[model samples]
Target: MNHYRKIGNILESAMKMVLLTGITGFLGGHLAVALLRAGYKVRGSLRTPSRRDATAQAIEAAGGNISNLEFVELDLTKDAGWNEACTGVDYLMHAASPFVTSMPKDKATLINPAVEGTQRALSTARNAGVTRVVLTSSIAAIVPGRGKAGPPHLDASDWSDPDGHVNAYVESKIRAEKRAWDILQPGTTTTELAVINPGFIVGPLLDSDPGTSGALFQRFFRGEVPMAPQLYLHSVDVRDLANMHVAALTAPAASGTRTIASFGAYSIMDMAECLKKAFPAYREKMPKFQAPDWLIRLYALVDADVRANVRELGYNPSLDEAPGRALLGRPPIPITDGYIATAQSLIERNLV
Candidate 1:
């Protein structure tokens, strides 16, 4: 199929309208800002309309033009306003999914909302005849459950084994992404699908609230984490991830493709070292040593977050950044910059 031609047609249209779900979220807020800055009319989805003003203010504070931004109430678990929200939309950016750091007793708490939400968004977009949909997936969908013996070099083609010994979040992401592809399969719908699978995202926060990624730095700054875990994180700046989502809208090559938006991988201690150098004031609070694997296991016994991700200890895999770099048309933003930005944002917002 000539994907380029489809995108060309989209560009020819004037002032496309994009329906962005999860606009109140961390990555979603960035995506909304990027979309608005790119001159698209964005109707941001919110579960509660009360957040409209704050969300708009946050986007505006982030240097986005919110003059063209509007809000609609929609919930991932409910179908009340989906059709009305999707009507006349040119594109759909589905970024609303349940995210939790700890493992849930009932996996369905995360899995059901994620998978069902994808279904609601994509199916509604198709019915509305939306041209293309940009879905926010995660590297979690591609990287986990491959086992220690799996391929060392991971890319878009990699799929996490949902049935394997993976966490609920990983399983949810894997299932949700698969459901998206299943719903938007070739020759089935006019809405072309493009996915952005990002890694551990970190960057400046648009609001005082620090989402999951930002909370990591919040904990670090508050001296909550005394020892760094032995986990390696594939990092990406939220700003770059947001830009990639905007780029995917008309990048014909992105259609029907999963783009890995990661700069590189760094260990937890590595991040600590970077932060220590950047913020000397927090030097005493920052983790000075990597926790032993055995100690981490024991800590997991009482820490739900640690227990949920205990399997990730020493589980770093190589990632191919060529596809993401090609999409960006340049090198990714430095991880160091992201680290600093996150720290500064936390301090400025008094989140720490």
Candidate 2:
């Protein structure tokens, strides 16, 4: 089937219900909006029931129809509602996972929740007979842990080595994604799985909260980061990322595969330039020069968070964009637009 027709058929099937985890998050909120707008009934999971109304408001503000949206209290660390939430769900969008820029003091704090959560979501979805599952993983799971001298270009075959110089967050994503694959091995269950390894995701926020990716721009705008680190990221807009997630649910080629969602690698200085061009008023605040490796090392000595990601300095890798282009059926949103939208959202919400 053609791309539009396939998506049209899925959208027209109003009976199809999607159980979406992490509906309150940056990507989750976008996914909920996309799923709802596409005519799927969404039952979003949340750790705190009180956030449901606010999350719904955020989704609604982002142009999602909440009439078909509902909420269930679920926790990654506990098994309180896994089976119950999975029951009667046609597809599972497992997007809920711990994410943080700063490394926790203990690695287990992040790793345990991420690994165990994927285990719970996949196991319960299989038991509940969900047709397919689309997991939201990160390029962090694909591109890190390899030394700075690793391959210039990375694809689905690449995996971040947990034993390498990866931090807690990268290790958690690697382990969690691995656990997901381990659970859904062929012959083990009828449920098919597709994983999306997206690069740095940035776009307009649905709410006032500046998520981990949004915080990148937040720091930049607020002059918290005076010097741009010698870092580069393969980037994507959250809207495209959300659509890619939904498309994976029905894309035949997506089954049993990891599709990358990134435009290309862009450096910290590149982002600063983009922002400076878009918002000339903020040009004075933008980092004029990239920090040298030795300066970054010295800064890390004073900041534990910087120390955690010290290994990432000067590391850059090209990501294969063919899978993303095929799945998206178009080029991903321009990286400059993604950067500008993020900054604009933060400014509009008074988050900066």
Candidate 3:
């Protein structure tokens, strides 16, 4: 058995419990399924219990038991109700956040909860005697954007200053992740923290609701993208990303470390071109034109999200995925596989 697998099995003998926030969200849904399959009981945090139907269906569809997953309604913005949620949980994967296409009224609205929520949860988890916490930091936390020459050499050592003038979501994730790592106290086992940062995550949707990344894939299949954006982002399969989270949680080796989980970056043109070649019949539908830099800039003026996305354009962000790949001990699911999987899901459901 693998080091982490052995650890998980040992944990299962006890009443081992893991708390995963945002279990209804895309990343959380993926993590919940993976963790449950590994035999550890999962306690997922939800903003409210009313939304359980959709999440339950998602777990059921993924072959996870609805009964194996438990929900605790909690709020990240407030200091109330965290103690019960964190009580007796063995590990934590803090995955909740306000990731949206629009900006928040106050940057702090997003940043404060991101920072504060982690503090609240970790504090409660510490008091409850949980030994390890794994945070779902993003590649956004690793590399926010590039300078005039392009992205700096990205490694575990690099951290994008989200509090700076980058996108609000970038800032949100940076603050949330930093708060998770800020754990420190005299004689505390819960102070042990690990973070998993993934890149532009893409894969088949666990549910019918299209994700932010899946929406981008939707555009490709709908023949609406018409052209490709000249941007490159490190892509990771959602399954690989979920596996990394489980690994970070149970692996003794991953304790007290932050790791980036991504395979590599590819251009939108490259994705469209790859789609064309992969599904030769779809070649005519794939966009042949590349959106020029100036046009992207022009669109940014009228659209804030466009402004944010345009900021990431014309730059190639390639992170060091070697650690994650080596840690997994396998080749990651190809970006092409994710594209096909997501595209096929939309096609099967008439979403496109």
Which candidate has the top score in lDDT? 2
lDDT string, candidate 3, 109-166, tens digits: 6777778887888878777778777877888887765643665468888888765548
Local distance difference test values of all predictions, in order:
0.88, 0.89, 0.77
Candidate 3 ranges beyond 4 A from true positions: 1-14, 184-190, 278-286
Candidates 2 and 3 compared: the better one by TM-score is 2
Which residue runs of candidate 1 sit more than 4 Å off their true CA positions?
1-13, 147-149
Stretches off by above 4 angstroms in model 2 are 1-7
Ranked candidates (TM-score, high to low)? 2, 1, 3
User: What does candidate 1's lDDT look like per residue over 1-352, in tens digits?
Assistant: 3366435544653488999999999998999888876778899999988999999999999888888899999999998999999888999999999998667889999999999999999999988999999999999998876544567788898888898878899999999999999999967878899999999999988898799988888778888888998888999999989988888888889999999989989998899899999999998998879999999999889987678777778788898788888777667899989999999999888887
Choose 1 or 3, whichever is better by TM-score.
1
Q: What's the lDDT for candidate 3? A: 0.77
TM-score of each: 0.94, 0.96, 0.90
